[model samples]
Target: MSKKCSFLYGTLAVVLGIATSGSMVGSVYATDYSGSETIDLSADITDGIIIKSGANITLNLNGHTISTTESEDTIYVENGATLTISGDGEITNIAGKANIFNNGTVTINGGKITHAGSYYAILNHGEMIIEDATVTSTSEGNSMVVNGYYNYTSTDERIGYVEGKGIANPTMTINGGTFTGDIKNCIYKGDDGSINNISGGTFSGAAACVLQNVNEMTISGGDFTNNNSGYPVINNQYYDDEIDKGVVTIEGGNFTSADENSPLFENGDNSTIEISGGSYSLEPDEEFIVDGIGFNQQDNNRWEIDAPEEPETLPTVTEEQNPATADDILTTAGILATLMLGLLAIIGALGFNKRRA
Candidate 1:
């Protein structure tokens, strides 16, 4: 064999062996897996992974691990791209943000996601929704954090601590799954919206579910537990300036707070708390006053929420016009005229009979 050809073949074999073994890693660029293909991260993916803009990427961990030891973000869902996870896989990042920005969604149907650093496990700015997923934060101090901003800012000084934050319009809808963390005022829904927790999953946090100056909070189902005492489970006090503007509706769920002051507080009269159904075990006080009905409980700890029947609407009545005494006199005059005509006719007939005799 020629010396040059033999040397080229030897180099190719060594490169192939490294790729086959799990020791060496691969640097997959954004364009490499942009199509409808699934990029399996079986090997160690060194450096930060950025699902660049304009790529509809499905990151199938394939039961692999994506570990990073850096202060920067490990996996970045850039503009217009998506990062979806399924099956028993894991995404681990310490000391950096798991940032999912503009128009991106981080959907985890099944897998274990650990965000251990001070950063958030899921930072959703655009639209983030979860179903049958497990999102956990092991960070001791604060497990999760999410912030949003208005599209524009007035002045640099006027810009508060959370100015120019995430998307102006961000949505967080948790339909099903389990989220375990000790969040502070961590989850921040924007001005026009709020966090909606429907049926399914478990949400446990030390701090209150802060609903600031925004719209209503409709929680139909789920399990919310606060082991702490005296602090309300949901605090609309953060929306002090716009207290009456904020509203909360809790139709169904199993809600509990270990502390006496842990009731869901409605700061203003307009800010209502309606309990249509679901079992709740809360030590109530003056601070935690719900405007609507409270969930009743039996002897056992199990709560019972009755299915509310629809309200019946009342029938409408029409009003009549006023009556006049003059109309009654007119009716009496007609009766008198008929009686006089009969008397005259009888006298005329008796006079005709006398003339004939």
Candidate 2:
């Protein structure tokens, strides 16, 4: 079916599904679109959309909202599926689970995933690339919960989740986004992968970023503000095993905390956190500081790079005050010439007197 017909049917389904209030009754539309498909929502949708199989779906909000009042995800992508969300629209879940639940590849280019059920705004189990988006929750929950893999061998298996364990990591590259929530950790990175790069984003929460069983992570740029007074800006939890230990490289960013004396970073045991760059409101752990980089306090509770010292200058000397000046040499030469001429005239006068005698 065409996109125009899909929108008409979607809106009609929502309208006809309920008689009293505008709500969806039973199971919403589940899309198993093969190959590639783009669905543009002309009106707001009060249902959930699931991308099944190996299909690739691009759902454009088109300046509209796709939300559901039921306890379900606004958009769900099954394993092996690919979903690319675009437009300046909103994907919200009211009194429900995460706004966008992904078990496959999901790339959010531009949009907002806001949920209210104190759950993750975006629960990512597979590869996720958030270039630009606003993933936030009003209640107390992590904004973006990234999972890798863990042992969930049970009837209710929650993949990529195991209390405080994450082994096989997921691949997530967050180039740009606006992630905020009133939770302990804004971005819960339980998936410890070797290639997780968070280049740019705006994060604000109790602890702006958290890392557990991290293999390797490089955060080159971002704006992180920790609102909670007790927590640090970046908290890397400890893992006991030697093989599971990993490194965290912080190249550049703006890290600050609301509390003046609170530490900006907490490097738990067994993790090597090398902070070579960034601006902080409080001091970081001395162990994480890299060599050659000066850490100076710019202002109250502000620490950044320290500038080098200036060179010293000497006083200027005048020619008149100097002993070996050109004027003194000329005066001595004139005196010597006058004295020599007088001596020659005296010798000539004596010789003339002797000749007369």
User: Evaluated with TM-score, which candidate comes out highest?
Assistant: 2
* TM-scores of all candidate predictions against the true structure: 0.62, 0.70
Encode model 1's per-residue lDDT on 1-357: one tens digit a residue: 344223322332342333433321322233443544355554544344555544565566667666555565656665456666566677677765663333365565666666776666665555566676666675544325342322224332112223233344455666777766655543333333334445666766556453332445567788767665665555542343331235656667777765555554435444545555666675333233355644455576655644477999887544345344677789889999999999999999999999999
| Model 1, residue pairs in steric clash | 229-259, 278-305
- Model 2: which ten-residue window has the lowest total lDDT? 18-27
Predicted structure 1: lDDT = 0.53
Q: Rate the local accuracy (lDDT) of all candidates.
A: 0.53, 0.67
- Candidate 1 stretches with Cα past 4 Å from truth are 1-28, 31-34, 99-103, 140-167, 182-197, 205-216, 237-245, 266-274, 283-294, 307-357
Report the C-alpha displacement of residue 158, candidate 1, in angstroms.
Answer: 17
> lDDT per residue, candidate 2, 214-254, as tens digits?
55578898888877676667766545443235667888888
**Candidate with maximal lDDT:** 2
TM-score for predicted model 1 compared with the true structure: 0.62
Check candidate 2 and list the clashing pairs: none
Per-candidate RMSD vs. true structure?
A: 12.1, 10.7
